[model samples]
Target: MTKFRFYFPDNKDFVDPNFDGRSNNRTKYHRQYDDDHYPHQILAELPYDGMLVSLAGVGTMQKRGKYYDQELTEDFYFSGARKFLRLDSSEYERIRLMGDCGAFDYHNEYEPPFTVDELIEFYDRGGFDYGISLDHIVFPYFKDEEAKDVAAEKCDLHELIAESERRIDITLKNAKEFYVKSQNYQFEAYGVAHGYDKNSFIRSVKELQEIGYRRITIGGMIKSKTDELLELLECLNRIRESDTQFHLLGICRFENIPAYINAGVTSADSTSPLMQGLKAGKYYSVNPNSIRFSESLMIRVRQYDHDNVQKHIDKYRDELRQYISELQDNNGFDIDLSSAALSVNECVKRLEIDCLKKLQQYDETGLDLDVTLKALIAYERVTNENYLPSKSTESKQTQLKRNEDKYHQFLLAREWRQCTCGICKGGLMNIIFRSNQSNRRRGIHNLAIVTKHKNNVLKSINPAAK
Candidate 1:
């Protein structure tokens, strides 16, 4: 069996649960927040075959204030990703590190931002197992941000085709040089295939094959529809050598994993279940035993109204304090302090922690779902970034009624309760909270699920492996 692999793209998504509802606050930061806290640390613990780190992503860490605050850009260049991730540790012996140009980050540049030699230096220094050549993306097919998915098909076909070929030409030129220049490097060299459509995709893959790349990754599919992706993969399979391996870049779907593996993909990377965490008011519920989200099982928050959430917290201050007091068991929980004595920010942080505490207790003993939901809903209210504005036309009562219906479905399913992933450590309910902690945990858990599905498919195809 050609063992299929799945690599997660590192988004530097580690979260500090104690984060004071502020973005990038230094006092709240921890290098190993996921490691130390429950619902497990994603990077060290995620059961993935490999991880893909983009040079473009690292380039941004050049600024002193970001998460990788301990290292400067030159520091990273010297130490490389392997040292950064500490993949050298005995615990991560099986996990491979892959490198990419992270073209999308520098898409606006007329040419790829980094040199071939620079990428080689990076991947080699990091002890990467695989690295891709820098390739400029075909821009026209990429949907413009404001237009959503409508922009891709709406682009002039002639322009799309012309621009795709132009970019493919540049990609091939880089690939030939990258492969030749990488002769002394230990990592396997893979080139990117950029196609605006089916034939062009095949042509690019064929060109990559001719360049002596045994492994090729198909890029520019983030905007493609499911059927379109399958179609492209099917065509590539027809022309390629039987042993040639392919990867799907930036694919963010669980459903796509097994289907694409069947269509000849060996590995892929994406920002799913993790990104699901950052999205407001949305939650993923596994489809019974399956990895993909079950719409019927998913939960919806009533609102991500940051302004209203703050207003409600202020309006119900006395009631919230009373509720906390009653739950304190006479010892007086730290949250029992008068609101007047605490800063508003401190109060919100306490309530958030209290909710996580309560949720953990509920997860252990199956506490009343209604009460747990109230606490979670409270935290969700305060922590929400208001990603989605309330529809001006909808009445508050209507949103509440719909959310109630969604909550009813969520309780009936409660599949998240069955998950044994580390993210549930904060409490099974913690995985469902709309806060940064829950969302990122859900995403990491989602990636693990995808890898599990990939292995399952691989085993099904080769039954003896079981």
Candidate 2:
């Protein structure tokens, strides 16, 4: 049976939960979290075995150009309600600080970013377990050519073909150099293969194998369709030696992992799960049978409108006050009208500020407050069911659809408490709602879950080996 591993890409501050600032800050200005309270500390302790660090991401984080001076590293500090010194590359390069690199960042560049010697030194210093040789790429379906055309003049077919051949040659040369130099290092090196088509990909793989690489990584598939990527994997599987392993680069969707594994992919890497939690409208949920997506309150904040956010705040506040009065007068409830009104007003004020901030940050121009108000009202209804006034049939139905997945997930977390993961300990609602800490912690939790799932799949497929 083929063994499979999952590698996570380090996309600057996205995958690094220890990133500093107001949680929503996702630019070059962000700094690393302090050592004592590194958000990824829990993740580091998890049994995740592989990491893929992008050289570009590292360069960006270090605020350097395409390449940085390896010897010069610095720590940055942020001053706010929470202030701490950031980790420099020197600090992050330690094995104890970061785990074994299952794969190193190599891309399709005109020139190799690091020479074989420099890469070897880096791998040795970082205590990496594996390294992928640098390679140039020719994107699938002539997308690269199209992109180039958009930037300048259109390339003729002959020119495109020549470019592809040149990329392959450079890749092969880099692989040969790496293999020759890697003899001095303890870490294993995997040659990278990039091509424009299935046959070319197989040819690249064969050439790498001939160059003494038993393991190879497939590149240039990031832009390929799922079917195209699968076809390439199948072709590689057919031609590859029995002992040879293949790593699929940049294809990390959880749903696709099983398919790739089935197609004979030995390992794969992606930053999708973490990225989704941080940037997308939904959070990834662990379900072996199917991929589940739960609504993220962070997305709600991002989608909030500034034009009429005030209207929503006012509407919700009035509704909440009316509901509280109804409960006290009609239901003869012992609700303190003044305190309830004050609480409602305070929440509305906070909601308005949150909405405005999101609007300004995202640069959205619209005036739809209904969805925002509905979400808040739904939460209020859920939390204070008995005291809240019953919704009208139309409003109730609308809210039911909106709240179904969130409510279900919340109940699941509450009842089973099945996930004792670090993030869950903070409360499931925190993971579900909008906040820097909550979103990042949820992302970490998602990583743990997905990694475990991938490992389990591997075990089930290769039960006798372990």
Candidate 3:
């Protein structure tokens, strides 16, 4: 069986996690939670085969040379808990090597591809079961962001694969070659996506099958348009019909882990604790059996709203309550509500509108294309920079006005249309009045073009306690 693995960069002392790559404000920036940890020792502690030891990409200034950080030395590996027990020299001889798909120079925008031979030498000398890492295999070209140029310059398999395949093939070939030569070894490759679509991912998986590659890992905190992570997993299930082991990246929340795995992901990874330590000057201190929120009061704040926005909040809360109710009623705890609730297409619609409202509130000019695009291209890359048909070097001020106008026009066109929020069906659109019911802001929920009659019926049936 292909074992599920975790990367552990050693933080033996749990020393101060600060580094110079960030501002000094102590803000938990994304990188703080996303990168940097010595993982060798930690990975050894996991009971599952899914864990792989990787050098934490923090504190290392130079990108080249045989040694990455202090973590790569054989001494460190030998001293690791697994070194004496699970990882013997003979076991190492019979081991397979696996690498994260995104760990190479080309993926990081450095010059000169790290050839497969160099990688094999490193893994062989390092004495690992598998050499695995991520590579930019499939580049999705949305509007203007063409993968052809990037592929031509960085990917050697450009002619052999599509935008998505280019990224997967590099890792696949590298792993396969290692397995063939070692005779005593086996290898697997993973594909990582910070931002790519369900369709593109499906296509990439198909191409992987065509080339006989079987393992895939998906995700990053990159803006994903799909509202539910479960939806993404379901898409993976569709791809895995032909037998592929799916891995979820950076999954720290315990409640969410089973959902992904149940949806067919063979294993998962979590850097949240390390990320938290780097971010807030402390670790997240995760409990694998519990669910947590980023802030304790977010759900409370949503629950207490005095305006129509509370309707949306209430819907989410009710959904949560319903899941719990189902768990109790069925006496079974393995329900996948994410896949059971809605389709990916429905999720994209709700996310696009919600993100658009957020962009309007956050964007200074009320038309920040980058921010909007970031949200817009959450799951998929809108690579076509020139795809903006209207604005050709338009001023920011003009762009804001144009975008606002477009937004209002969309409202007018979709008027009387009942738009159900993707997160919850109970939140259909209603006519929002400019009443200062609470400290509420005018949001997409406020302007939702939903089935007001159905909302009225729900309001009548489930009125808030006065």
The lDDT leader among the candidates is 1
Q: Model 3: per-residue lDDT, tens digit, 139-256?
A: 3332213534554577554453443454454545554464455454444444343224455656655655565555666644223333346676676687675566776654534334
Sliding window of 10 residues with minimal summed lDDT for model 1: 384-393
Q: Rank the candidates by TM-score, best first.
A: 1, 2, 3
Using lDDT as the yardstick, the better of models 2 and 3 is 2
lDDT of 3 at 335: 23
TM-score of each: 0.75, 0.64, 0.41
Identify the candidate with maximal TM-score.
1
Estimate the TM-score for candidate 3: 0.41
TM-score of 2: 0.64
lDDT of 1 by residue, 44-127 (tens): 345578888887777633333223444545566677766566565677778888989889887777787677877787787767
Model 1 regions more than 4 Å off:
16-45, 60-72, 139-157, 280-364, 370-399, 412-416, 432-434
- Clash count list over all predictions: 7, 0, 52
The predicted structure with the larger TM-score, 2 or 3, is: 2
Candidate 1 has an lDDT of 0.65
